[model samples]
Target: MSAPLLAIEDLSVTVRTDEGHAQIIDRADLVLRPGSIHGVVGESGCGKSTLIKAVLGLLPRRSTIDRGRILFEGQNLLTLPRESMTREVRGRAIGFIPQDPFQALNPVFRVGDQMMELLRWHGLPGESPPSRGRIDRTTRARHRAHLISMLGAVQLADAEEALERYPHQFSGGQRQRLLIAAALACGPKVILADEPTTALDVTTQLQILKLLRDLAETFGLSMVFVTHDFGVVAQLCDTVTVMYAGQTVESGPVASVLGTALHPYARMLLACHPDRAADLAGIPGAVPSPLAPPSGCRFHPRCPEARDACAAARPATREPAAHHSVACVLHDEPATATATR
Candidate 1:
């Protein structure tokens, strides 16, 4: 029927440093269907956020994407001009919620202004700027109404009062909710949320997750959420992509991957989480350096299952069943959309 909402094939991003260039995203491949929450989980420095930034063309000037095809709604994103890219996807076809809510919003502008800008950029009627110098009363009123309606959608009460307050006035959770409201205000088809709950407390984290799920369902938004925590992924996502040293190591339905992880890195990652640990003290040692990553699997040094084969060559992704896939050598069968079954 409908084609996939987003498809990333053989994606790689490189950043130039004083020494030389280093590839951060190593041929990462993934797909996101309409209204589905596909998660990218990994340790710190795993290039999870960088992947989203790449799609948005928001990578640092030093960073360059060397290879990949990012097709969004059947259009090739990388080839599209930057101005058009900003107009279409930044907030129209997609939205981005950075990990830090406090930083994402502008301290100078009122919350309403940010929302107005998003609408204006998408060319929403009545909010269009005639020029740098001029707009009338009608546009202002329409902007206010739009802002208030969006405020209500995020479960933020006192919409009118909140509009007057600057970004710093709101609590951490409220600020996050505000960002989400803005991200969804444009009716984006895809929302790239990078650790949306990391800055909030445990209770607030749960509440925000529930709100996100509710909004995603109501709006039919396909989400690409990034987080290092498995607990969050388990609760909010349907499918997952596990990354280590910037490469995907395993991907499958959340339940299957979590319960029966085939990749050595994936297993160790889950064991390290406090919520999943029974007697295991969690994996010792940190993720390898992105600048000088370990050879072959890149995770071979940390993987208990690491073998001569793993150290010799990069393991190929295996599709053992429909909808299930793993990059570890442990799985010999190739996983496909229909294979996980």
Candidate 2:
């Protein structure tokens, strides 16, 4: 396939909690192909957001990437200096759409002003200057035109008028669309959307999902979409990575991974989906704390298929199908040779 627009390999992140170092992410792996939507699905506290932040080099000061590489266009993001990440990567090469629209947009600023500031700082070469200069009419007009075009592209009604309004004036869905617009403003290669539709109503959620899918296709943008919903992944993602606790349990083409999930945790997660479960069952037991997770597989305590071997050591990744990998022992050896088949 196309060289990965972004590839996260064996990424591990930790945070300094009162209890000492808490492992927030454990060797998480993900790959985003050009012009495709890759979904990162997991329950809360599973390190979904932490993975995204690690990719963007936005990990908090207390957070540390203990190992692994975040390769974007062949460059390891973890090694890039803060200045390079700010000027060359984040916002310019990779854009972000946060979970909350109400909180993402500044309440005090007009939409136009906020967008103009983005353009002023991160806009394409020649459109933005290194140092602040006179806010000339030509610059203002160019920025306004681009904003209007992006707003229109996102289907925001009366784009011109909408730009003059404050964040409060727009409905939840409209605000989300505006965030999408801003994320696309700089024409980045990839967009990291951290459950952008989680706060919207059902109908609005569907609308946002469709918009995101369409935008990815239309702009040739690869997106890493983070969400807890399998239905959303089935609808909008070309590939999916399932994370449990702080580890990635399964990853592959959405059709392959979702249709015949090999990992016990992945299977249990699928069973918990509203459409798949007969009575809307929930996964047994709770997610283990990162500070003191289970000895081996993070999900071993909750996995119905767990065995003595599973709790002995973390499972190694095995591939039963092309482009599909699962970190579970059932897919291994003569003892369980047919388990995944």
**Candidate that scores best on TM-score:** 2
User: What are the candidates' C-alpha RMSDs?
Assistant: 4.3, 2.4
TM-score of each: 0.92, 0.96
The segments of candidate 1 whose C-alpha lies over 4 angstroms from its true place after superposition are 125-135, 333-341
Error of 1 at 292 (Å): 1.6
Against the true structure, candidate 1 reaches a TM-score of 0.92
lDDT digits (tens) for residues 81-134 of candidate 1: 997787767777788888999899999988877777776656443233345424
Worst 10 residues of 1 by lDDT: 332-341
lDDT of 2 at 194: 98
Best by lDDT: 2
- Per-residue lDDT tens digits for candidate 2, residues 93-168, read 8999999998999999999999888777776533444354346677679879999999999999999999999999
Task: Assess each prediction's global lDDT (C-alpha) against the native.
Answer: 0.83, 0.88
- TM-score for candidate 2, residues paired by index: 0.96
